[model samples]
Target: MSLRIRNLQSFLRPINRRFPQAVWSSRVVTSIRYNSSTPNNNSSRRPNSGEEGSNKKDTKDSDLPATNDEHNELLEKYNPDKSSRVGTPKGAIPAIDHDLASLLKKPKYEYNPENNTNEVTYEFPPPKSPKQLKVEKIREKSKPKSRFKKIAPSLIAAGLASWGIFTYSYLTSKTDPDKDGETGLLRPDKFLPYVISFKHQIDDDHYLIELTRKNRHKKLINNETLFNGKTMWSIEIKQPDINIVRNYTPLPLYVAGTDPVTKEPHLRLVSESEEQGKFIIIVKKYKQGEFSRWITGLNLLHPVEVRGPIVEHKFPGHPLDKFYIKRPQLANLLSKIKPDPEYPEKLPKPENYVYYGAGTGILPLLQLIYSPNPPKGFIEAYLSIHSESNLLDQFKTLNYFAEKIGRVKFHYFIGEKGEHLSSKDILKPTLPNFTGLSDIKLSEEQYREKLLAEKREEVKRQIANGGISNEGKKSITHEEEENHTIPKLDVSKFKPDNAFQQFNIFKKRKTTPDPSFAFVCGPEGYMADVSGKSDLNNLEMVDNGPIGGKLKEKGWTLQNIKRLQ
Candidate 1:
């Protein structure tokens, strides 16, 4: 009986436990909610009900937080040094532990939120002590210095190399040549030819020294035979005053303007020297020419080598440049003055005209007037001036011009100032045939009367105004314009009929038929004589000795004379 009762008890207990389980299962079904609806405790506990299964799993996972290795790792990473835990926003996670953030805090900096973005950021830190800051700054600066240090050795090496190259070039340039050192190019190691020198009175007003170089082959040294007639020598001038040196030393004289008829070489630049290894040089010793004095006083043998023959003018055409013209008259005149294909052209009909010359200043102007292509509407004219009587007598060329172009009216003043000629006497109508002469003689009585009368009239006028006191007499004399009609005092006397008989005198004058140019040389006086009186037009100044008078209106060029070993 006891065994049967025990069996019933066991059976009942099993049945009871099964009944609770069944009840719990039933309750879960009735209270269950779908995943699409709000979660509730009455959800089905069965695995088939997705909502209940997921909820149960979540609850279980929440309860086993200690067992989650991932949570432990997260907590380990978030643990900061000494800060409190901070609450995070819902659905957001904290990136760092509060303790770690405390370590980054500094004085003068507070975390503040940016108004626009609502983002928190740290403010600028406080400035450190000056000494500590300076130390840090120095370290920062040293970084750049370290970088440059690497290249310092290389820079030093490069500098040394460049210095070595310069030293080598300087040394090489000073060495002597192998041959003909006497006549070779001037160099440090070679000696220039020594020339004998002596001084002589050139005139009452001046003294100059003549130089003669050591024996050398003239043909080899002077390649151009232009100086066959004149001497190939140099002169050293000596004057005391520096002012005289400045006035007399014509260091550089250049040419300007084009040859009216021939568009030949047009410009020249010249320099003069009285030293060794040089060609002809013209040095003018004006009474007040300062540079002349300086040049003349130089010890010619004291290694005083001069440089010159610089060409100021060049051919208009070139590969690298377009010629630019400056003077308008020259441009216009040059365009019209084309070269004539024929050897000679018939002379134009003679027209009466008068000319005035002022000392030697009228030279270049005269050349232009006598030029074949003289400015349009030019007429035969008279010339007058004090005679250009000198030892050299370069003015003789004027006679040739007067002979060829029909005699120009001439009034000569020789020795002291003499008779003043009237324009009517010089500008008289002339025939096509005319002649020119260099010297003319008039009776002294007539010349003296004219001079005395002119002087008396001047004194009479001064006394009429109010007699000059002794002091006033020493001062400059002023003349009334009306009283001094002086009529541009005729420098030349004209015998138009006499000139007409001497026409066609230039039939034998040699001319440079080819494209040629001309240059004028000598003192200001000499230059003026040729410039104004010569047949060449557009007379330009040249730096060196002349090549030919035929190409007188062509360009003056600067040429260099080189001494080769």
Candidate 2:
């Protein structure tokens, strides 16, 4: 163990001879240092700081196990790489201990980018706290929980609040708490309850049905805006079973006939009191008409939904206002109808009228004529019937008019007899034909002026009769301005004497009358001779096109003629 060979001599000897001499030394240096162009990759780019990086650096400087040094000599040296550092005083160099324990220290090579001139530089890591490693390990173990899981409860609460708002809005919309009052026999927004009180089966294809309000005793909206005879109005019957609605024209007539009567009474028009909460309809089911078939198959006392008083066609003016009151005025006079007492010419005489109808197209007109207060004109209705049996089957319908209606003359064109309505038949050779428009214009002006004169006459009569009181003078002014004369609803409201009421049912009018209007309505080709080629395919009630048919050639303008559907 005491055999000591010099260090320089051992390095110069052969490999086999040096091994024997190295075995006698206390420590072995397993590496030899040398310089090369390529940087030594054995060093890490930058060791992770702490005890681990320093340990790695210590072992790297020498390829030997950690050991004590043989010499106590220490040297102060200037690292050349740190000379490129900025802001150092001129010729000022910092000293570093180049001892064996300081071999772990390494300078970081860097280049100064801020300086315009390119230069090499070095940065030494600052000394860290000895307990920095303990702080980092604790941070790794104590990380915060995921933020999404924390917000889950808030998301669910917001979703529930939105759902509650939507549910409230939907329920309120259905209830419609703020709706105003409705004014009709039927409501547009919701269907009112009704019971089928009467159903008459005319044939396999035709039906006469009546619908009465559930609360039958109460009167409907007490107004005549639609039921007035001046315009043709209709309503729709809904079939909830099929989810469909069909438009129907309701007649004022109800079946007064009983099954057991020896002489079945003809269908009769309803009195004003009876018309309040009841209506009748004529339904003719076609081959594939689903809505019609459903209605025709209903039973008496079955419930149905109805809506409207849809205005179909409005005539020119209230020409009959002077002669008519509310409908059913003739119901009391059915037993005995007589002519009006003839007097010298009245101020405003009624006009003459002509009408052409094909099949069911005549229903609207029938409503106008049967209603008690018809226009102050007489109508010559020319109807087209499919066959002779059609008339026999419609006996009750014909009887209603023949027995009660006045001022209407019917002329039939039987299809089975091979007869069709033509323009020539509408205006015969001997009939008054005023070709020039002056006659029609003069008639219209005369009609308007005569209306005013008639109103003044009515006012004079009321005054002359000594029926007005000082308090009633204000009401007289309003009555004179209004065009129509409405009947009194309550018996106490009548100003007429007791004797007049007892004999009031005896009132009548002249059978022979005036005519002015010419109306045409039917199938497209059925009345082509009188009206134009119309497109009835569209169900909407639109304005008819320019009057371009045989009636136009016969000197009829819109002033005197109309083509109705």
Candidate 3:
């Protein structure tokens, strides 16, 4: 009560007039308090209106004495350990040592204005924590790189491009005295030079042209071994003007003599000494063939680009091929067979190996049969033609030999002669079921994919568990097969062109899957008639697609038929 009276006296003294002490002290009763200097304590009571302005009657709180009780309470509230109030100073906050420069607050230093000198005394940039220092370094790195560093990649790329262009020009244009403008031997990877030697225009559509080495001094590497084989191969002659290429099968024939009757060239093949790198190719120029048009128009005695004795197909070589049967040996075999000009007693039991060729497609077939040691067993050749051709001379020569030898027979189906190649007697007897090799291979591939799936999961598990130390980069070497769905075949890519006709010859019979020995080559129409048409893979190489066509209808698979490109 005395403290409340004292406090009210101190408060009311600041404002002039005294408020009733009862109103000042008791908040609930809406009153205050006061202590007077005189022992007349009734001085705290409200005065009547006439005595209101009397200054002497008022008491000041300064006159009131201080109590030990109030002073003791002040000391306790400030001392955190002994403080009556809650949460005045919670758990102790860390403080900086006085000796070190702290970043928390600014230091005080000033200059005397009269003196033209600074009185400040402190080092700049307070020391940072380890984490702050690391963060600062990262920020510096994240900033954009200097001019040189920013453009370094582009500069490097330009330099490399310039170097490549210069290198290619220098290497290609640089001439060697012995090389004859070529760096090395003929190859598929590079287009090498060859000079056009001789060309014979058999007709407006047919051309028999010859290509020989540009560098005659630099002999080719065993060209005989490269060209002669059971495999029917061709070379790609590139038309540089249009940047196009066409594959042509070369014949082993040459001008033997000029015909005394008409002064035309007489053709003859074979001479052991003439086997180096000399051969001629027969080209038929179709109307829309840019490659053919450009090739035939090429200047004589000038160099043209050519590549490869590209192996188109490799047939299984006969066991006797190792013996090297010479022309004399072939002659002896021909002399042994009794000559029968006509089809005698069931046509020599029909040759096990059969060939169906149309137009110039017969060139490769001729190359195979005319080779020193031909395929074992009789070969039945069925040649199909749409018109009468000058090929008759060569045909007569081949058929004459075929009749003398009797091991091979030539069957011609000339459209002009009222004989069609699609004769049932020709195709129905053959066309075997292709042993389902394609299906079997697909099954094996699917099984391999299942194994690969398991392997991929194992690899993922290892990666999650941090097996780098255990594997030592084994995953990089592991073949990662694509998890792609089996793509549908693009039938349009292999579909016959608008120019070519498609023939359909179908026969069905119960067949045991047999190894296919039949090789068919012709225009789209004829091919459609024989085994189905073949397609090219993504690489543009001939792909024996899932065998479907006449052959497929007759239960033939890829294994049973080989289509020549």
lDDT of 2 by residue, 87-171 (tens): 3133312242366224335454575554535545536644557689778878976887578867988999999999998788667
TM-score of each: 0.23, 0.48, 0.47
lDDT for each residue of candidate 3 in 1-565, tens digit (9 for 90 to 100): 5655556444433222222222222222112222223455555676677766564445443333356753453343233443322332323323434643232245555854435456454455357899999999999999989999989999999999999987886786656433455544457666777888777777778887777667644454443433443667778888766777888887665555567886556665544543445567888888998788777877777787778768777865322333334222132133332222222221121125667888888788877765544554456678887666647466466556653443456778888879866545344334322233464455456667878998999989888755666547533332333553588876535533211111111111133222236678888878877776778766868565666555555565565467887
Q: Per-residue alpha-carbon lDDT of model 1 for 288-380, expressed as tens digits?
A: 855654455556443233222222223222111122211111111222222211111122212223333333323323333322223222223
Instruction: Give lDDT: candidate 2, residue 67.
Output: 33
> Lowest summed-lDDT stretch of 10 residues in model 2?
70-79
lDDT of each structure? 0.34, 0.57, 0.57
RMSD of 2: 24.9
- How many clashing residue pairs, candidate 3? 12
Which candidate would rank higher by TM-score, 1 or 2?
A: 2
Q: Where is the poorest 10-residue window by lDDT in model 1?
A: 225-234
Off by over 4 Å in 2: 1-183, 187-192, 219-226, 241-243, 261-266, 316-328, 332-346, 388-406, 428-515, 527-529, 534-542
Kindly indicate the candidate among 1 and 2 with the higher lDDT.
Answer: 2
In angstroms, how far off is 221's CA in candidate 2? 8.1
